[model samples]
Target: MLKNVLKSVGEYKKETILSPVTVALEVLLEVLIPYFMAVLIDKGINTGDMTEIIKYGMLLVVLAMAALAFGALSGHYAAVASAGFAKNLRKRMFYKVQDFSFLNIDHFSTSSLVTRMTTDITNVQNAYQMIIRVAVRAPIMLIMAFFMAFKVNSELATIYLWVIPILGIALAFIMTHVHPIFVRVFKTYDKLNNVVQENVHGIRVVKSFVREDFEEQKFKKISSSIYKDFTKAEKMIAFNAPVMQICVYTCMILISWIGANLIVGGTMTAGELTSMFTYTMQILMSLMMLSMIFVMTIMSKASVERINEVLIEVPDIANPEKPVTEVANGSIDFDHVSFSYSQNPEKLCLKDIDLHIKSGETIGIIGGTGSAKSSLVQLIPRLYDITSGTLKVGGRDVRDYDLEVLRDAVSMVLQKNVLFSGTIKENLRWGNPNATEEELIHACQLAQADDFIQTFPDQYDTYIEQGGSNVSGGQKQRICIARALLKKPAILILDDSTSAVDTKTDAMIQKAFIDEIPDTTRLIIAQRISSVQNADRIVVMDNGRITDVGTHEELLASSKIYQEVYYSQVKGAADNE
Candidate 1:
């Protein structure tokens, strides 16, 4: 985990190195000041020599200013290095998510990924800054102060050794108890963020159902969990300060008592005893800083593990070696394919799907909600790899093609009908970045979207809210269809994309496909039989299996399931009339 995280410090290596170097210089100068004060006391003040006092005073002033300068430089370098490191880490995680296949995303979930990038990264960034500056300064100061005290009087210095072991054991116990609680708290944070995201995205449904109080309670529950866990962890860490204070004061009392006795016996001078008191404070203060570093490290350890999970995750789908670059045509062949979202054969969502589609053919797929109509078409673009068996696009295994080339050749307008926040022109250009105005209008016309777009003041240039929130359901579907049309792909899959449009408009869009792009293989998935009645062939799916395949008339005559669906729909229409 440490190795992976440090790789993000690519360009900031110089600043990372300089921060600790400057901190060491600051500590060194600070340690020397107390020793020089001892010289000014014994050689100058006690000896009543004005020259010695003034010379040592000036030297001490220079050391103090130099220490301040180095301390400020270290702070600046540590800040820059930590912030830049965070930027690089976020960039790497985002780019890695882009490469993740649908299966990969399902494993981590959207809310968890968002939490890892945001709150978790902030924790790691703060920890990095402390590690470079305070962490470096603490140990160096402790050792130097203790060494100087030993040089002054070896017997008195041994007091710190007894206190050191006791303080170390206390801090170790606090860190061990707090770390697991912190880990659990961050996981609760993921749930809290997930709740907020779901509430905002579905605010319309929530309001329509008048569930405001319910949402508030749900949010409070998760928030309360975090608060409780954090409180417990903090209560444990609170022991650190009092424990350090006990050790600090005990060492001071011991040093003062012993040094004064030694001074009275003339074994130690007044100057040496005064310096012993300063070294006692310095050594104990360094230990206090070290305890704070331990606390920060315990909190950030969980965050580091979460971030490393994203950084090292291998995308489940990738372009194979020596991949086929170009798709020959829109032909798709499913040869005994079986798929399970969980990759377990016992829980297969699609099973043994043997079907053949030629280039330029128009196919319609109809099925009940759980029948896997969308699953069959999704394999063409390799959005999710098949669990078993061969699935081919343009006469080659989908795994054999480069991911980008294969997906570009196949255009899919999914059931969700998403449109980003941008001008309509900008959103449509996702299909073809270089599409001309004429090409844009032509595709919209084919999808039966051009008429409504022209009614808006800006027409194609009109701004669309995120997810096309300002538009009606039918309008969003039509705009999405037009965008897919701009791709001009060999194969176009509409996964129940036109469900919101009226029958007349739906028929017109199908007619446009038949007239303008007859050579493009079109697979239309719909609930209405009227939408697919004129297809070259229609497929009926049930319970993850294809139960019937024929032209519309043949299925109506022979397939019992198809006949039942057709008669029910026809009776409903007649009743309406």
Candidate 2:
């Protein structure tokens, strides 16, 4: 845990040390105040010197005011530094997540990462503050108070020093017990977060199914488990507080007992005995403050380790040592391509697939629910590398091309297209930032989105909520298509992107696309046969491999898989009519 804490600090070397140094000055004043109090009590009060009392009392006030000023300044700096560190850490983590290939993202879910960003980062900030604020102050006060006690009477201070080693042993025991509980507690917190996220996002589904009670029960089970784990960990560490307090109080009792004997024997004056008691109390109280920091450090160590896991993950697809890519036409060839997601099941997503798509031709990929259509498209853009075969984009192997170059040549409209919280023009501009008004209108026309967009209150200036939730499904799909069309790439992929639209709009969109982009190489993945019937070639896949390849008429005449899907869908459409 301590190692991880040091590592977390090591990453933010610039910001971490400055605040502590500023705070050290504030802590020095805290230590100085007690000595001033001692001087005022002994040098002024007992000796009956009015002039000395007023002078030292005024000095005490000045020191206290100075202490307050130091505290406010240091506190402002510390907060600024801590918040800036957290911001930098989160931004770095977010970029790291972006750089990490899909495999790393799959390993950590959306909710899990959210918990790491929000809850875990907060723990680190808290730990950082405690380490700066209390850790420095407590030890300095402890040392200064001890030295003062020994100056007044050496015997009483010795008794206080003896209890220190026992406090250290008790602390060691508490830390030993805290480590495991903290690990379990963090996991439990992630689980609880996931459950809450699911329940909230799918609250409508839960209500529709009338399973609110069921979902609530499930949440309660996880929540109760988290509650139990957290309480258990707190109690394990909480035992240290009472135990340390008892030891400190015992030392206090011993000091009062021993100091009185010295005073009676005329070895210690009354004022000297009083100063020793105050110093003993200061030492024990400082130890208690230090104990709180110890407890926080134990928990934060786990959080830092969790954060470090993300910071160090290197992406599989990074800059190549040497660059190589040259292609004019958009052509794709997959030779015996095979891939499986590294996670559970390990079922092959694409198996022994071989296909070629020519430039200036439209290819349709038709498949059932789990037939690897999306997986095949993902490989073309190299979102996930093909586990075992050769894939070439534009006559060159994709791996030979720089990642940016390959992605630039290809534009894909994913099935779940999300628009940011911005104006309609802003989302479209993401596809081609340099596009003029005429170019934007042309792309929107090709996408069959110009009609409805112009109907809106602000037209192009209309604001879209994040994920385009404010718009209808069909409108979002058309906008996504417009965004893709605006890119005007050498290769374009629409992965079941038109699923939400009515058949008429889908047909109109497809027609405009064919009219405007006839020479642009395209791959259309759709469930409906009518949508793909006009494609130059159609590929039919079953399970994970392509089972058929031909024109619409050729597939109806030849492949069993293709024939079955076509006739089933055609029959359903006719039955509905």
Best by TM-score: 1
> Candidate 2 — which residues are off by over 4 angstroms?
1-15, 325-327, 343-347
Write model 1 residue lDDT over 1-577, tens digit each, in one string: 8899989999999999999999999999998998999999999999999999999999999999999999999999999999999999999999999999999998888999999999999999999999999999999999999999999899899999998888889898988899999999989988998999999989999999999999999999999999999999999899988988998899889988998899999999888888888999999999999999999999999999999999899998998989999999999899999999988999999999999999999999988899999988888899999999999889999999999999999999987879999999999999999999999999999999999999999999999998898999999999999999999999999999999999999999999999999999999999999999999999999999999999999999998888888999999999999
* Candidate 1 wrong stretches, greater than 4 Å: none
TM-scores, all candidates, are: 0.97, 0.94
Task: Give residue 304's lDDT in candidate 1 (0 to 100).
Answer: 97
Candidate 1's C-alpha lDDT?
A: 0.94
* Residue 435, candidate 1: C-alpha displacement in angstroms: 1.7
Q: TM-score of predicted model 1?
A: 0.97
Candidate 1 local Cα displacement, residue 407, angstroms: 0.7
Q: Which residue pairs in candidate 2 have backbone atoms (N, alpha carbon, C) closer than 3 angstroms, thus clashing?
A: none
Summarize candidate 2's per-residue lDDT along 1-577 as a digit string, tens digits.
4343344443455545655665677767766676677778778998999988999899989888887887786677567667766777777788788777787787777777888899989998888777766687788778887787777778777887677888788788888888788888778788888889888867778999999889889889988887887888888788877877788778878877877887788887776766676777778888888888889988988888888877766676665677565556789999998988872236678888999999878999998899999999988877888788799988888888888778877889877888889999999999999999888888888888899999999999999996787898788988999998887788989998898888888898888877887767889999888889999999999899899999999999998888888889889988999
